[model samples]
Target: MRKGDTILFETPPAIAEFAAVGGKRESEGPLAARFDLLFEENTLGQETWEQSESQLQRHCLDLALQKANLAAAQLDLILAGDLENQCTASAYTLREVDVPFAGLYGACSTMAEALGLAACLAAAGFVGHAAAMTSSHFCAAERQFRTPLVYGGKRAPTAQWTATAAGCCILAGKGQGPFVKSVTFGRVRDYEIKDINNMGAAMAPAAAETILRHCADTKRTPGDFDAVFTGDLGIVGTRLLKEILEKEGLKLDNHQDCGLLLYDIDTQDVQAGGSGAGCSASVLCAHVLPALRAGKLKKVLFLSTGALMSQITFLQGESIPGVAHLVELASEKEGQA
Candidate 1:
């Protein structure tokens, strides 16, 4: 039933195909080969980081469409976003691709946000096929959010490296497998966290909010799903979320963070691990979806977390606002029919 902010899709939409493309650094990570394709260079043949960001989105979309035996023109709608100002990276990427486009921005949570909206539209018979995608570039994000790359200032230990990657997933009114059963859109949350360096802390409450809210709204427990995946909360935020959930008497038995899973904490020296819209996007498409397809996972809750802070807001000493969007994915063999 379409009630409140969450939509329970009676005819759950299935992912037809998905593609995750990453930069060189991401390719060297634990889920290395899980990525559909990897660019050996961060430029991706683009002359600028912003252009590279656009290219990343295009690459993922093209690959996803190719895998699904479809073309850019075949998609009924494209819901996508990125961290760039105005979401220009995603907008410019699909500007000429010729599909009905909708630009979204949930920061890192865009992956779930885009997917949930697409699933709802598709499942409701509003579209025959839809594509959800997002991308981010470390250099581009750093330039926009922080300091100059050439400045080379010391990065705080609490900081997370923005992932340079992109992921795309296609959904149809009906498809083969890995269906989206529900969506719980998050409300903006503020913990009054002022440290721009500590995004995990800023976003953890929102993640906790969406998770518990999804449980309360759906009448399910943490044990109901085989896995619960949160967006880029890294180590610190993951711990904070656990504590918050524990205080509420709901222990997350099977939970992991895309940020923590993206990089090697010990060897990579990525500080708190990876964050950005692409972190969850790439990981979900490349790793989690594959596991679901393989029957290794049955039911899963995917939460993409985002920080809603702007440079101006941060400069003005305002607190960071956080958000998280949730979607339930189930293996095709096990999805409600």
Candidate 2:
């Protein structure tokens, strides 16, 4: 397998800076203080949800550049993605910016996928500096994935609330802060669960497979990390992942889910918890990165999970497929020190 699915970067690219922006609903969450910008209106001063999502991307880009103290022209490339079909939000975002951009789609796993690619590019010396970012909007996702807002249909307990937010990070050739040590790209796993409403169940197998592969390839264990975070598994998915890992004779000491951490599940009425691409992206940018930078977290794993399903496939009675990607981040070489 040649080091397997995990890619160890020789140069070890580091995140120079990052930024996270959220919408009104997300701003009301427990991690509200971490956000760089929160919009009072979901429109983001725009007329539609799609436009608003694009603005969210733009907001993250501007804030990221400001935090890094770098200009737009200085970025070698920008990698971005979103939940909209055809990557509409990311496409519009790139159109307005002059930097070279690559659009990505991994459902909710976009953030980890994009960051892994960006880190690899920088680590390989192909790019000196690159921007990796992603975003999601509740209104836009629901309208496309399920029913229209006007329908006002009841949601199941397993349903997750898509976060309306954006997260962007700048990867440099060399710097401090949370640095990428390795990235494990996941393979598609379909467990044959066809309920479109149950996203956590759809994505759990993929998450488990990737984590197991990464640990086996790197010779690391759950206790080796300060925290292991999954993208948007919510309450249900978290429990499922734990069970799957245990059956494989692996156990996690400090495991967390971006979906569960984003909001108060009991009080927020967020069914299982938060989902969507931006949920993990925004949470990591606002909370996780800060912890890494502050030395509170010595080593962490950001595993983004995605459900590879579409309206057409769902209508055709096809089961949902899933994928996950993992990025290992360390706090500025603390273990070696």
Candidate 3:
């Protein structure tokens, strides 16, 4: 994270490739429609983590730049990453695009970090435009970081299915148009939980810690913002986060704090909570952006939480490393000084 970064951009614009809830092609399997939404196909045979995740991010970014009507050369940086270890997917996808880049590692918090970086750069007058992008593939990430395809290990009720998707947003300086207003980074916390199956429990404390810090740093009350959203903590983690926050003397109202679990899917069973880089990306791209445009929400605080652990660490009896990053999104136009 940078030392000094403030909001100077007007407002940021985002885009995604998935029908979170309903679409004309709901009958198609999730994989097929996901590809169709991104204007790609499974030409590489079975879905490889590298191919699909990279494709979705690349296409989504192209669309984002197009929407913003800016050429690739205009961007000073392309901050991108994903949940995969070492961020292989986001790195590979960024290679194909044209921009100076910084690879980030925060699992689900990748996108938030990227946005924060861009906002900081723009505010510091380091660049006029920068883009933040991230993508996740259920198959690729699971096969590599957690379990193999053949394992098929039984998932506990606390498991959250990784969502397969990608999201991109264009953050421009005052010259580039409306963009991010402000970004806050969370301190990484060490939680001794090592079991991967119970990720929600492991990550909850981190969320709680960050939520309190964000409220304090911004000097804002819970009721001041329309909603406070967490990236993926699902059911179990969300409850734990709220509980921990209140215990710390910070009260988060029910409607005020919303968790991006299961996206817009209810019938779909998400065990502990939704977990993935795509979980927060998809929800923000689909619901939050539209809600902001519709004037349904005024200020939104998006806090993306991640469990910073690897299968190797867990196997070696290492404790899980968890982190969360916060980005403040507001629908109202900037107030002139």
Q: Candidate 2: where is the Cα deviation over 4 Å?
A: 334-337
Candidates in order, TM-scores: namely 0.98, 0.98, 0.84
Put down candidate 3 lDDT per residue, 1-337, tens digits, no spaces. 2223223334443222112221121212232333224333432233565676676676667776776777778778888888777888778887776789888888877767777776677666687677777767767777877788689787788777676666677665553222345667777887687778777777778877766766665566666777887887777777888788778888788432223433333555445545677667656665665576567876677777788887788789898878888777766556410
Compute the lDDT for candidate 2: 0.92
> For model 2, how does the per-residue alpha-carbon lDDT over 208-302 read when each residue is reduced to its tens digit?
99999999988888788999999999978899999999999999769999999888897897899999999999999999999999989988899
> Model 1 off-target regions past 4 Å?
333-337
lDDT of 1 by residue, 214-258 (tens): 888787887898989999999889999999999999999799899
Candidate 2 colliding pairs: none
Residue 250 accuracy (lDDT) in model 1? 95
Minimal lDDT window, size 10, model 1: 328-337
Q: State the lDDT at 328 in candidate 1.
A: 91
For model 1, give the RMSD to the true fold. 1.2
